[model samples]
Target: MPDPFDPSPDSGDRFTFGLWTVGNPGADPFGPRTRPRIPPTEIVAGLAKAGAWGVNLHDNDLVPFDASPTERDLLVKEFQQALADHGLVVPMATTNLFSHPVFRDGAFTASDAAVRAFAVRKAMKGIELGVELGASTVVFWGGREGVETDAARDCRDGLGWYRECLDFLCGWVKDQGWDLKFALEAKPNEPRGDIYLATTGHMLHFIETLEHPEMCGVNPEVAHENMPGLSMVHAVGQAMEAGKLFHIDLNAQRIGRYDQDLRFGSEDLKGAFFLVRMLEGTCGHPAYDGPRHFDAHAYRTEDVDGVWDFAAGCMRSYKILVARAAAFDADPEVQEILEHNHADPDGIGPILAGFNASNLAALEELVLDPDSLATRGHRYERLDQLAMEHLMGARS
Candidate 1:
């Protein structure tokens, strides 16, 4: 059986994992601040042990967004020391745009200039800290960049405010010479009725309009995508192809519920497998410049360990996906389908007809024959055996 952990040429280069600890140690995602079960250091250590490349830290996790300079400074120093002690690098950090009540109207898109300025100032401080901590990217998920009542508000003006805010924020980052990227994560509607950049395509269009190479990019979240009835695989593919897929936020959701950041692979295994394929098979090999930001909502009550377990499960699922994709690609029938589809789009009708009537039966046997040497342990082994059999006659 093939080793699922082995890295292939197409495997992802920078294996980034995020720690969404904004409300950790005490605070739950919804409410009720519990006692600290595990310290932050242990979480970092566990991530490193689990083969993660880096960690994503949120602004609140490091310090209160509205803290005094002296307080902020102390917290910054503490965060830096924590990272150094654990040998964990922060690839990204997000502003505390969602925690405070002042952002009810919106953060960057607030109609009130005062609120907008405060939000920007908060984000700038977070960016500076992220730079200090050697983070590669600063994420901006417009938690409040939406409209609850569009009837009273001028939609165009609101959108204009958002673009202006992004331009200003992104420009500041570029001027800092921080070698950092700005990732904008989009969610359809949660805190607000209608999010400004609610989809990957919408993000792409916005980024193109920004025209700042270092300014903006999309961080597509799995559950976020699924919530809007979008296919995760297609979304990832589109982002990759557009050269705008700057970061990734992985999590699962209940098919049609609110953004539930469940553990990876918890929902839609086949879809999750395909997402893995898109990440490894396509996005991994390229000189893809970005981060894999985990925007997870801590679903379990165990706190830190639960988050670590979720991250580990994500990695394991990634392994399964890569293995299966490799095997699928190796199959002659699959290859034939791909080639025919690519070479002659109209030829698919005739090409598929060439397969014998018993082919489905044979394929089923190949997939389910437990005693078969190929049907052993890992999913990779089974897939590889099936592919090999398809490529080299079944009798062989």
Candidate 2:
């Protein structure tokens, strides 16, 4: 439904995108990167002109690993200047621990003591960078913090190591007096057969075990959750309800497949629409007010222009879905359906309250009363049709 040929309109502060989203060569393990590497400063300029108020990145994405102290300082200074010139800000920053060879075993869960310590240091450094960049959230995506086989390591030790890592990070933040929060990201399986914090539920529970639970939250990515065919809206709602939805990544993926990181609304429009509604909806009172970063990639077949189009499309599609959701709310028929039959049965409250036998009788009567039951009319097919019409822009 996207018009790739349309002019790229400014999204204002409605969205933010990751620095890594641009110029992806679409490489795999066996293939090499084909897209030209654009400098991080240039990338910031492009995103600013594209109308993003903020950008997210991994530390190494903007700052090279092999740079000397002076070189790193120069790089950071240039990046800071670029931000000032373009009026852009940093929403989040993360450590790229998995890409380095030292983390072949894992980052936080590495069995080797030196490797584990180095991973911790790298993460601390990444947090410092985020603080310097005025970022609100620091993300930890443990892509390499898992084992290919159970026999390769002990699960207890791995969990303990992960706990130690998070506790240290939390303590480090307090020591530095930074105002940033940590957003822990999760994926079921990827570089490893099973990731340590494998889902939003698991991540939330683990966050409670941290030294500063108040400073820890989850950064749920749509594609990561959808990889296992999870209801993206349900996963996001869980994080939002807990008031721990620190950040979000918007992307698309095929069911039960690799982390494709497909363009937004490329695979699932209904799912995408519902997600936008839940995030931007007033009825539910969305708990998150952070940037919607498009952590997706361009297809291998596309060129540089296609990459820009992909970026524009990400913002445009999300804005369109948000508008459609607003329209859905304004529609009188939709509101009528919601008021009449979208919620739990009205008789349920009385049935669940008092334990008296008379109350039980009343509950039974409510169920047996054909007239009351018949009044609960759910026009699901029509409701779905209404949403579809909006999605297609065919209200007529």
Candidate 3:
């Protein structure tokens, strides 16, 4: 890796991984686990050795589903020991609410009161782990928070239930008085036919209805945004502009498809280019200082070694794009185009003052003639070609 502190740099200690990514074993709805189930500590150790700065995890990733309280303590103890030995930390934690069969109907919007209560308790446990591990935030991806058919329940009720659950969780965080925050991961669909709060804008708007809206934000996932055929860069840009980009999930997906969870930069390098440029301040925004957490999983075709490669590749692709972004900014043509579009501080000073009725009326005939003024169009194709060339280091 190039030294990040150097005058010219490529990478830095800004990469984090989800423990589930390295341990997924390439499982899917149609398939079983292909690789052996590795222990939690080993996963953390492997990620550390593979160059991950830290990790985030779903609650069940480290502890067994039915782990006793004593067992939970032992597991957290071992996990913390591994972290101390490897110099790693947990930046975020999430509850695995969509996996269990009980959540088939939904967690927060379950028809069964008992099931809904159970989901809430499970989330509280997730928060407990986050607090114990000193996580900066807890993420909630409502994978099954909606229904398959319109006959099942009103979507309004689902949204209301979601807000209610969030209100409780946010209040719980405050009552605990820990310096932790919560993020809502918006997925268009997958485990369920439709997911409530299925986009960045939906969740951001929903937060306003909550009593503790200030405690919640969105952790927009790239693949999720791409699944709905939305502009991934624009979605992230909106989150950052709203100060609700509490965390991020970096991954790849083909346009208008299932959630592939492919490795970052696998399918859309250009989209990743603009996304990284946004985070790196190549656009006129402040650079994001939060964790670049990879919430992606390995392909079902991959083996154990492939899993590690996918994990490392997330950071590698991000660094390469950062370099490309710097190159894009320093290019003279790009600077010229940006400057041409920029509103100069001096304003159209004397020009606006000269737009009096007399001269304006005298020039009406010439101004009204379409052929009199030549069109000055934006050379967007040229700019796009420039970006592509720089992305591939082909600026010869």
Candidate 4:
């Protein structure tokens, strides 16, 4: 329910999309074998050419956590220069907390204090890079924050370790005097049986307890929500209503399965469409300051280009949804229907029955139309015009 007459903000019109590239571009999915790699600079250029507003580079991309100082410094310089050359901004970056063998037990959640300390150091480095690159946010995905076995786990100590790490990181960022928001991306279970913050609800609880309103927020990935048998649109709507949706990550959800990171609209098209509409109808016109975060696993062999294509399509889809929602808003007859529905829910059947076949046909026509803007224009303006004409003649 946005104001129909309000001018769309520049930020809303400029839809930003991000690319998530962490691991080997051509690494085997089922095995640990690596293949020939593409340069990260080429990836950045490709994304910029494909109409992305920014990129989400991982800490590992800057320098593998275990690399020598010389190697790390060189890699960081190369990435920073490439981003500048391509006019790509880094809105967010993540720590490499999962890939190292030292994190087999966990990184921040490890029972060993030394391991936990090492993880914190790595995260601090990543945060520093984010600040240096002028990123708006930094993400911490608890990749190893889970237990494979219930019998041998020290739940209390593990939880304590995680909180400590988060508090320390937040405090460090606050001390820096940066306006960077720290986002916690939640997943039900992957790489572990139960992640520390497994759902939006869990994340909310943690944020409330932490009480660091300026430092923390949730980044709900669409696929992750579906993995836990929750509706993505519903979950996002709940977050929006509660004023907790600071950012979002778009990917297709495989019904009743783990995170797939498939192309947008690949599996649950209805859900995807609704999500686009919700984002537009709510966040689009107002101009959200946060980034459109992405957590895409490289599913296609084309590597970087494929990732960009998917991200671009997602942004385009959202734009189309926004335009359509605006059309619906401009239609007086449609507004009347909505208003009447609000006033008298039980009276809807009789009113709906009046148009019956024609109404059903018009809906199908509008939804199935190929031309995006034209379809919306016809459905909203034309349908309302026809309805108004009929109503006036009947009254006469």
True-vs-predicted CA distance for residue 74, candidate 2, Å: 0.6
Give model 3's TM-score versus the native structure: 0.90
Best by lDDT: 3
Report residue 203 deviation for candidate 3 (angstroms).
Answer: 1.2
Question: In candidate 3, residue 246 scores what lDDT?
Answer: 91
Q: Which of 2 and 4 is ahead in lDDT? A: 2
Residues 87-169, candidate 1, lDDT per residue (tens digit)?
A: 66787877778768899889888889999999888889788877777877778888888888887468778778878788888
- lDDT per residue for candidate 3 within 121-187, as digits (tens), equals 9999998998889898899999999878968998988777777887888888889888887888898
Instruction: Please state every model's RMSD to the true fold in angstroms.
Output: 10.3, 3.4, 4.6, 11.9
Weakest ten-residue segment in model 3 by summed lDDT: 2-11
Per-model TM against the reference:
0.78, 0.91, 0.90, 0.76
Quick one: ranking by lDDT, best first? 3, 2, 1, 4
Measured with C-alpha atoms, the lDDT of residue 256 in candidate 3 is: 90
> 56-148 in candidate 4: lDDT tens per residue?
767777566678878977877887898889777777777878888888778989877899999999898888877777777787788898788
Tens digits of per-residue lDDT, candidate 2, 1-396, equal 845323232423446777788746667787877677778898888887766678788988888888787888899899999999988889799989899999988989999979999999999888888889988799999999999888978978998999898898888888888887999998999988888878888899999987889999999988888998888888889889898899998998888989999888888889998898988863457535888788998887777778877887887788778778888877888788777774665556757776998887877776467788788658888889998997888762
Give the lDDT of residue 339 in candidate 4. 61
The residue pairs that clash in candidate 3, if any, are none
Question: Model 4: which residue pairs collide?
Answer: none
Q: Tell me how far the alpha carbon of residue 116 in candidate 3 is from the true structure, in angstroms, after superposition.
A: 1.8
- By TM-score: ranked, best first: 2, 3, 1, 4
lDDT minimum window of 10 residues, candidate 1:
6-15
